[model samples]
Target: MTDAAPQGRLRARSLGVAAGALPTGPLNAITDVDGVLVGHATVDDGADLHTGVTAVVPPRLGLPAAVHTGNGYGKLVGSTQVDELGVLESPIVLTATLSVFRAADAVLTYLMRLRPDGLSFNPLVGETNDGFLSDIRRRPITEQHVLDALEGACGGLPAEGCVGAGTGTTALGYKAGIGTSSRRLVADGAPVTVGALVQANFGGVLTVQGTPMPVEEVLPGVRHEEPPGNSCMIVVATDARLDARRLGRLARRAIFAMGRVGASYAHGSGDYAIAFTTAPPQRPPLPDDRLDPVFAAVMDAVEESLLNSLFTATTTTGVHGHTSHAVPYDRLPIRPGTGG
Candidate 1:
């Protein structure tokens, strides 16, 4: 039980907000990357259950994808293939830790229906522990839930905070959840959009663009460590064409952005980021020098995406009456009460 947030959901640049130089797309979300779709299945039994699944669908199956292990410390299934082959065959699913295997199974089942005659497939899955507000032992997620997310996926600015895999998640002692942001860049005279989506469930002194928030002051007596060695699942999407090797380089920048927003990268934290693009080769081969603008866009978008997760999240009560309070918008340096 915490005081109501003074303002409604808003991104960092809403009220006199200025964090990045590049302009954002119309939606300012991962879906800003054409053909990239996102969907969520939130489970809120109106009781202790507050977990769900989030599915991200690329333009097509088997696209270039890569992951950067910022702090390898949790269950990330199908990562080895993505590391070795540098491609993804199935949609990416995000869920609770224990449900990762089940989520992957659900993905495979769906893929078989799409291609029954195929022999091999890889389902990219990532997770963040949401035990703070949900009974993790119950493993509330189901294959149908996974399927629903995938089937319902669509291209647009995704719903953020306290939905999808971010439900029941805690970050920087606040009730953090799903968030997204995007940046537009002109690469080789073509408009390139770099968008970021985040499951904000990790810890540290919460910072927004280098300014830290007084968590204890805003949410007095809030527990700073209930979630226990939490993790974050960050997904970056762009229209810039790059293979796995280059994608890996772009993926690491998302982690750097996480740090700027106050991720401690704890010993038990499983901080991971995956980067992909829907762009096709417009020329024989693109040089590495052209990636500089894309990298800068990724960094800013990821940073703002994390802050959006925190700002949009409202106070949530959970298992055993343990409440994860939302970060007070008034505590932020920028003026509140506006939307992006």
Candidate 2:
């Protein structure tokens, strides 16, 4: 979390924000984790296509990584290999449900071109169906879109709310999009940073810091609706030395933030979390006992990031004139004086 604000984008911290005891890094974004970069390719082609791609490009490929499935209902490409082998060979990508295979192939193209000699790697692509607001069957995402996100990926505040893969997403009956937050921490005398980024496309009662904001009450004309099987894709990054096993545990803690924010984790919701460490491969892994601080940081950062998604988004109208209203700023029960 840098002293420089996200230009003018509103975040949870903007309104005198505090999610937990730990302090946030300068950027207060997932980019606070050294070497972790983010980029988005938003597609808005008139009425039919209102979806795109988001890429979380790590400094190096094949970093020690792991994925934890909060619910087993997603089209997460290349997850099994990472689960079995415990390493991520590709950048993490998020997109609409039908575009997953295309996203995977695009990454493969990016890799083979980069490693012309020879390359064997599994591309991790996570997806959430955005049919309610977009024409998903077209699967409009293309290789160019993935490459654009990857090539342009840089370290800084990632544009959130109704952008990239979140362009057509709806969460808790409100318009939801990309959201991010990070924490600065010390473990065993070693300084570490933990950050979370999410594609919040799921459902639940809207709650911020234990205070509830039912959809009907906040969005004047919006009706209460819970579409089954929607999803959320969570990415957790840390500079702490950790192995794939420990990363799995950390990933689970990241998903727990969904519950804290009132996520349904419903049967149709494909809730998944993937985590990685940018610590050099040669460094010793952090002790398990020292991980309590890391867990708290993850939960706090993730909860706030989800809130950021809702706060930053604008009301959107997509396919067939279907609309998803943004969570109104005036109506939110924000800690007085903290909201923008």
Candidate 3:
């Protein structure tokens, strides 16, 4: 429900830095998709902890969903079920790497409490290592934090950078966190919306629309110590009526978009993307021939979301006095009106 960026921080688009030419939805956020809600529960203790939970809620459970794993280097609870049966019975949750299990359990608890009659449930939970800036060993994410995030889910522009599961995360040698973007297009004369939310914690040679970012030269003395093998979690939502099979294709496009942002997919990176649709089940699936726009939208939204995560994040000092500096505007090679 919270959509406020950190004080004095601006998103990638605000800085005239954009990823694609596709038009964004009204909020330019994942929540722009009708019936999709997002919320965050940040647990910043101000001393050693910088971790939390992010919840993405759909209109209902048992929705058609699919997941694509770019690299299976990290844990993703309930991914097998989603990949096999193509059913998402619970809201998707993202959190710190070490606390994924606790976050998953909390999600089950919340869903069970909401629908006591449901016997079997599959809770999808994803994570990225935040140990660089958080006391990951403490496992600070409690069940209450998950509950708060799930209960507070709302339909609006969600906050970006240094919040929710993105807290303490660093990407591409820069401090990064939660970011979201959406694309609006017309397919077969009917409007369709595709939205994406990303927890960017991986590393690579940063790029903006094919232009490489010279971090060392631009931001002198800023530490880029986070390894190239962290992770990234992407959740995509749409209002298009699509089946699980086609949704899987859409999910893969989301991961492929990572390359657009220069994701390394290193040995230890666990890159995954999950796509789900909110269109009513009674609606017929959109034919595959008309899916080009949808796929393009997914790629653009994912790319933009990654940039927003880094651009909006602020520098932070965490456990063991480790610091992750934010990617400043001056570091980028592209700017407004100059044409990247």
Candidate 4:
């Protein structure tokens, strides 16, 4: 995993003991969720348009899974079947709102090309608005871009800030993009892995741990502002054994962690979370079979992943020349006696 800071002048420092005592996974990323792969298709043409696509492949083999939860505020295609059947037989694609159709088509093409054996393809694709930073009207995300992301999928620490679909994204009026974090949990004397990856585009009055700290409190010239349309699509994955029902519960708990970070679920913000478990499948008539241990790990991973999203994001600038500042490390009120 790369310890190097993001590729921008406004990058923040490392976690620096500010993340409490929770032990992060080897890569401190969603990729640590075994067999998971992440890829990016960032478009930086120097035309003041910074936007792209990102794909998260739960397993290269396209394991059968489930969504288990749904949100009306955002666009999550191919989730209906996922919720009804408790299986997600495809990769999850993330891209700007306007490019959803193109992304979906591209994903279909990629899958078809991969398995040219006449097998049907139904992909899960999520979106958040990036019109403020990119020429969304032009729909710059081409079929080629989608294919590139799929072909480039690999395991390791994912690049953060100004990369992938998060390139022009913002959070709490600050520049934000794709951020990830993970955690390991113990249940029934067994360890499990849970992880989260987020495409952050929301904005609001910045706060930390319930304390209302506006941007001005931390950085001069930084104002308390909101994006034209703010939203976030968070994806959580776990290797612990969990049924679809338990996975839904775990996904809902992620919203609580979002609240802890000071998000009130803004009116225009399409805040949504999708969670899944890679535990071995159970036979029919056993919905609750072997799920307790996995639930515990899901909760632990969701909490840590939310924190990582915030930490990994760096300041960014986008279309219309809007700029969001990075969170200042020195301004963080690290608790005493805690080695942050």
Q: Pick the candidate with the highest lDDT.
A: 3
Tens digits of per-residue lDDT, candidate 4, 1-340, equal 3344456322122443223244557777789888888999999775567789998887744444555332357788888877777676678889988888889999999888878995677878988887776767878999999899988988898887678988777776566778777767665455677787888887665554445656776677665557666788888887766666766777776655565556657777777777776666662322454555444445445544444455566655666666667766556554323432
lDDT of 4: 0.69
> Candidate 3 at 283: error in angstroms?
1.7
Q: For model 2, how does the per-residue alpha-carbon lDDT over 23-100 read when each residue is reduced to its tens digit? A: 888788899998999999999876767799999999898789999999988899999999998998889999999998
Judge candidate 3 at residue 112 and give its lDDT: 89
Clashing pairs in 2: 1-25, 1-26, 1-27, 1-28, 2-26, 2-27, 15-338, 15-339, 16-338, 229-268
Cα misplacement distance, residue 223 of candidate 1 (Å): 4.3
Candidate 2 stretches with Cα past 4 Å from truth are 1-9
**TM-score of predicted structure 1:** 0.94
lDDT of each: 0.84, 0.86, 0.88, 0.69
Model 2 lDDT, full chain set: 0.86
Report lDDT (Cα) of residue 340, candidate 1: 31
Give TM-scores for every candidate, taking all chains together and pairing residue i with residue i: 0.94, 0.95, 0.95, 0.87
Model 4 residue pairs with clashes: 16-340, 17-340, 18-340, 65-87, 65-88, 133-319
Off by over 4 Å in 1: 1-8, 281-285, 337-340
Candidate 3 lDDT by residue in tens digits, 112-219: 898889898889999999998899999999999999999999987888899999888998888899999998999877899999999999978788878777567667
Is 1 or 3 the stronger prediction by lDDT?
Answer: 3
TM-score, predicted candidate 3 vs. hidden true structure? 0.95
Provide the lowest-lDDT 10-residue window in model 1: 1-10
Per-residue lDDT of 182 in model 3: 91
What's model 2's lDDT at 124? 92
